[model samples]
Target chain A: MTADRSSGPALAVVGATGAVGSVLLPILSQRADVWGDIRLIASARSAGRVLAVRGEEAEVLALTEDAFEGFGPGDVVIFLTPPEISAQWAPVVTTRGAVAVDQSAAFREDPEVPLVVPEVNAHAVRIRPRGIVAGPDCVTAAMIAAVGALHAEYALADLGVSSYQAASAAGRAGSEALRRQLSLVAGTDLGEKPGDVRRAVGEDTGPFAGPLALNVLPWSGELREGGWSSHELAVRAETRRILELPDLPVAVTCVQVPVLAGHSLTVRARFENRVDAAHAREILEGAPGVVLVDDPAAGEFPTPADAAGTDPAWVGRVRASLDDDHALEFFVCADNLRKGAALNATQISELIAGESA
Target chain B: MTADRSSGPALAVVGATGAVGSVLLPILSQRADVWGDIRLIASARSAGRVLAVRGEEAEVLALTEDAFEGFGPGDVVIFLTPPEISAQWAPVVTTRGAVAVDQSAAFREDPEVPLVVPEVNAHAVRIRPRGIVAGPDCVTAAMIAAVGALHAEYALADLGVSSYQAASAAGRAGSEALRRQLSLVAGTDLGEKPGDVRRAVGEDTGPFAGPLALNVLPWSGELREGGWSSHELAVRAETRRILELPDLPVAVTCVQVPVLAGHSLTVRARFENRVDAAHAREILEGAPGVVLVDDPAAGEFPTPADAAGTDPAWVGRVRASLDDDHALEFFVCADNLRKGAALNATQISELIAGESA
Candidate 1:
């Protein structure tokens, strides 16, 4: 599902008033090469707001170590903050040469960074030794983009996720504490016999210590002691280093529902040989950012309002787990703010502007 | 989770105004025991409404075929409709001899149907052959009440689930289509753009043909032209006829979350021997209606908002899934409106009233 590239780079969106940097500024202003000039930059409490570019508005500014001072090296910089503001503005905008493209977890498992997913391992961004470039965790980029399009067709072993995840990936204040605990269980006062005043308001919340509306918070990020949670070891070490399966065997379980932006998952995977569930639903009905809404009689698959705000990765319940004939069991839905975080940093800034065009 | 009951039978909820007969008439009038006179029935558009007993209010009669007329010959019914209204009210309430209990999926994979689960097959309901005593698809009775209390101290085989399910097990109009598609994505219009006005207001509802508010649907029921989905072969013939593993292989994936009740699962299981995930978390921390709530270094697992409206079955992300020493992974939530449907039909009507006391 490609094509739509109106033109090339010269960007910068850096935390431009948050939330997947305001959805990677109009999906890079709806890819209308609509000619260069982006530079939005934010914080200092979103410097003088105003956004909507190429049609008007624009002016946001602020952010500094001198908003990059001379700055102009911007030919792509993305990083929607936190990992301590992307470990300090990704080496001050890739040491001023630019091409940062992050989405924090502060440069995924570092080893000289390069997590890119311009369609899975966009040639592991020509081995980036820290002009940084990481970006995973949106349930490891929608389960390695449906396991790198099912490792390009049947060949994945040991993966068993269980993510539901949402509350805007714990942002926008955990989606306003799941819209004030589902507006206090839809104004529950169950005492007169509706639910016994919501079961005696048992377990309260303050941006989730529990009770996020109709609840579901299987402890997602930050819990590292041994109960594993840094969003389940960064989705089991980035789906085993982006499916190059360095000894695969991944079993993630990053919960956090009360969704407000879609992230649903329930994968099962497990193969090498007998993959049947009708050839794992014909290799996820011809893979690529998946869409196969499996039909089990007729409760059709894939939903998050059919993958809220498109950018595909919205599969459906594809079965075959009655015990495991090479286990398969699916269900996905993306849009964790567009293909999990500003469309993988604007498709890795279009493969870093197609390798510096 | 027993005692908590008193008196006994005179009960007959029979899908009494649905949704697990309105959480089984306030747990059969506050923690069960209906030993005489209590009927409820449904459908004449939920008859005369009103539901509650110990705390007053009862009237809701409609389901006929001579609505088990003035019961006297063995009064305990239960039924919860479907499988074509329990195959036309289980042989008309077990042929006038009233003993039903059926939760519909017809006679759950009938082998002369026993399918009970009063704590793992109440002596296969003393050989039910026709009195039609069935019940177990509330995710196979909260997953064999957590694998038959961890197969009563470790040793089981081949299993794998992937549910997340909710939307009130598709009833009470699929819990009002997940609370009116989560009030149509919390009352739509989330523009500053991200699924701008819900793909131009697409996703209207009806147990979902569209719109499930802040979404995630992945087929709940229907679909099975040999590609599984009567909620994945009722979790594989009710967990192989209640862990009597008739060729045990059970692979499920019945997801559908908007979180209006609980159901979460993410299992892996696999055994035959090996078993180590800290001795299957000390045999699921000493089983029984199971609880463990795993630790995963401390994000402390199990969720559906901590087993919403709890009644146990809560385990949590245990581990050892990856280098499978007999595989494990974890998580299993519960409360699909009380232990997946009115407290397992009020604990199989207190084990058919302590087996004829």
Candidate 2:
């Protein structure tokens, strides 16, 4: 899918009023000017609402087939909507001769649609035969930049990851639910007894499986076979696909923590070759889209509080496994709304824009 | 190390005013009366305070050699003080002929002293050649009961763990810091930008390496060799010692979360034989110190909120690894104060009391 280069390619953003979209607008205004016209599109309920983009007020367009009438090959439409909406509208926009960069799971596993993280697999974006490119899940997007950097040096063979996912990964409702629950439990001695937090959080769990205030929920997305969550399986599948390791042994446990934004992960990677912490540090320090915050002696490890609005994956706590010299362990944090969602999609859109130019 | 059973063994409690000590007193009073007289002991600063144990107020005695003069061979003194205090006073209490059960890291690595998780290694308490017993760290204590039961069935060969440790793992001050930091950031939009939370929680991290309010600190305990935290190394060491798998390949990452009291762990265990989720559930259900809460279809997995004031290790989210049939993945939660500290120590004291009887 090529865009006409008469002028810079136009960009259409669906779900522009959402959590990720709200973060995307300010980012679009701040980054290099690569778009001719930026269109803000949303559901009927949100249509006509004025949103600021590129320092100008733009009215949100309702989601209809007419919304893509004038879009052409050089234009790009980004979908930050839920999977169902993206699945329904991405093809409509693509059929109108524009490229669709989707941040939904609808077509991520589709072999024809490339799952692109520009830093790790920019080349994958060039071969999107379906005219749609899928963005990786927030959890995968948050860590792949750093993990890809390490894989280039160590030839990763096995992966074990435990996530400390923030509430924002579930979108606006998740974040509001956590804030409301925290407000209900704050200044009270609530967490010391069984079901106290649950009772305090009655029926306001938002989109989560249980109360997320003063708690960590081990489940994310719907339950799958063998008791795995859809989000957990998505992480395993997407990571293998992006890393191009078809048979990598991947085990993941996804957990939802109480943070309002920024997702953190504890990663254990075993490579085919022997690896050490110092060399891993050197690799991460030089990798693009990765920021090394190591130097624990100086209290400089990464945490969600520091990584919440950052663009790069903040990596630290790098160590060689005491039992296996082939294994390295590290901790990583990234703003789930930025690098994990909007930033990666914007980066992919830029890659497509350059191609059309 | 046997206690005298003239009537019932007298129990001496040290660090009576601290976090774990405060929890231990109530537990000792609620459980069966295994002690003839309960003696409260603390530092000179807290010597005059009165605390209730066994439903009676008792005057606290200052820690001095004279305090142990009346303690004899049938007495038990439980030390919940800091490592240095336990290292100093444990031998003194033992010299006076009372069995010392220490909940400090000072003697955990001592070959002469046994690390006892009463449910997993009750027999080890029988041969305390140094007349002192050590309790495992909170992380290890939180999950060992379930892991031990699974090990008995499949024979654990390798282990990997990532902990979602609560603030209380650092003691009362840790909990206070989180509550204070929460109050500072509560009802305010603080976590979205870089350093906003740290700025809001300026210089009051209290026993943590960073701001733990709305954040997950990956560094716990002092930074050790190769970027591993002391708490992380302790989990690996203590798990091996208690499981008696000295050469077991173990990797651990201890992270401090925003939760208050319960410590949760995601564990990956590879065993000698093939393990399945159903069979693992059966074993955990029958395990003495484990409570099975599997059944994710009904929102029935373990969380710190539900396990905070609980006695047993709440085990759930059990699944056999899709890649490695011999490996099983699961989540476990336990109250860091109860089973992780006080309850285990009290259980060991009761074992001694039964010996005298």
Candidate 3:
């Protein structure tokens, strides 16, 4: 099984039938032709299913220890599993000398695991002593590249972000739950009065704590003490780590909107020096992995629907902060399934491949 | 025409059948039993419709010059009409010696007309040289009380706010439009991909610039140059004026969410002195017109659904910025039809009654 080093790394995709995995398969087929054998691994129930990638059908393998029996040191495994699954499987892959690029939050804070956004901190990928490159949670990965680009030139001092996250951020189950809830309450006057929403969407709030169809829920992820949600805490930490601003003054409020795919954020950034809308727009338009769609008069700005299925983080509504000369306010949106989760993980794996070769 | 001054002033509600007026009439009846004659006036089409107030059916009258023909100095008028109607009729009422409390943006920036948020700047009500007091826009009025309360203690220097505005902020038509659009797209597999929303909600986006059923539209109000919406600019100006920080740095983004009644805001405030979340929570808890709900672990934070019929602005998610000791970040939600529009207007009228008596 010794292929030439130049033949490229063997890619193994764990949780290949999950939400991000479904999205990642198409992206992998479309973007990375450098992989030798693209292996798809899922739970036992999905193991016999065939998934189409790059115009070819790949049989999904059951994700057990025996599945990786053939995996070698030259292999790169991308995990799109739950935190518990990643916690169980990631070390096993890395122990077999394969690089594990995890999309779970399980190993993100580990000192030996390099939490990375390739565009923002590719250098961190090379320093992973645990052979693990942790992808940011979908919320942070959605906007950090664009935010990081601005911070690079402006010396970002503080960030205030309000996220309008999509249903798919919680994966396939979350999306299905929203769809089910929407069917129960849509076309009805559920939002007309207080408790009306509660009455209409009774006992069917789904994976979300509240009904998200025709409504916005201010809390996301697991609830933490002092009214903090785990998603908000993770976004703050991930963005801080990716931008290398460990003490970055970042206040994030994660609110789940009814969008199915893209995650949208309204960001207020304070810089060390004055920044104008024109200069910010110029920088954003030319920034890597960022698309600036800002012409308000033409009714042009990024929305979750507009950013859905897109790879780049779309930035718009760029304005100079009227209250602070050093601050810039803008909106950012990206596909939660794409750049926000799967693509970023794939990019990290590609970085490892380039380095190992 | 004035009987005993102890009997209280006459109250006329122009545009009484409109969305804000409908909400205001109920609040007026509930809060102000002092008003003598509560007149309900609307356009000819709605003139004959009877609306219930204070447990009685009040007959709506046509909003004509003749409607105010008997109005005198001892009378107080509340204008919940659109800006155009307010511009035409607010001056007419003032000329007839009646104090006009306008909820519309018609007189907000007029030098002689003081824009009043009673809890924040009630003294401004007595200084109305034009015989008119203006109320803040629904968006600003919803959150200013909480922000103002904190500012009174800490000297707020800068503000960044992102508003999660509801459909009713655009009036009854806006709410109806959202309902219709939601019926068309919700639970229908519309928001799964880019442009899927547009394709599904075709030609039914209504008063909104885009489909607002399950999607969050970043643009609100009429578009302005440099991508600022009119609502954002109005909030900035009104907030600065009410807080008496004439040059206060304010950056606002008004986003239309799918909620029906409550308008929510995420505010980041920088003060002149360091403020902690615990201290901020204490001030917010005792602040007039604010209900502090900060226990996130019990899912106790406010959402639009929770604030739908409430009078007070619900405040929560209070967190002191880790980067700036002087800055505080929090979330606020209020009934857009109540505190945002009608109740503030009603509060201003009560001020006129107490002074004129």
Which candidate comes out best when scored by TM-score?
Answer: 2
Residue A228 in model 3: lDDT: 67
Candidate 3 stretches with Cα past 4 Å from truth are A1-7, A223-226, B1-6
Residue B129, candidate 1: alpha-carbon lDDT: 60
What is the C-alpha lDDT profile of model 2 across A230-326, one tens digit per residue?
A: 8899999999999999888899999999998899999999999999899999999999999999998999999998999889999999999999999
Poorest stretch of ten by lDDT in candidate 1 chain A: A189-198
- Which whole-number lDDT from 0 to 100 does residue B11 have in model 1? 65
User: Which candidate should be chosen as best, given DockQ against the real structure?
Assistant: 2
User: lDDT (0-100) at residue A292 of candidate 3?
Assistant: 96
Clashes of each: 36, 4, 2
Candidate 1 lDDT, tens digit per residue, B1-357? 111123544667777776677677767666635465677778788788887766778678788866667553455688888778778776777677667887777788878878877767678887876877777888877767667766555556777777777677777776665655455344333522345435644555666555454555666666765566667777877888887878877677776666667777777777776766677777777766778876645445666655666677888767665466776667787877777767877787667766665
Segments in model 2 whose C-alpha atoms lie over 4 Å from true places: A1-6, B1-6
Report per-candidate DockQ. Answer: 0.17, 0.86, 0.66
lDDT values, one for every candidate: 0.69, 0.91, 0.85
- Per-residue lDDT tens digits of candidate 2, residues B315-350? 999999989999999999999999989999999999
Assess the local accuracy of residue A185 in candidate 1 as a C-alpha lDDT between 0 and 100.
Answer: 53
Residue A296 alpha-carbon offset, candidate 2, angstroms? 0.7
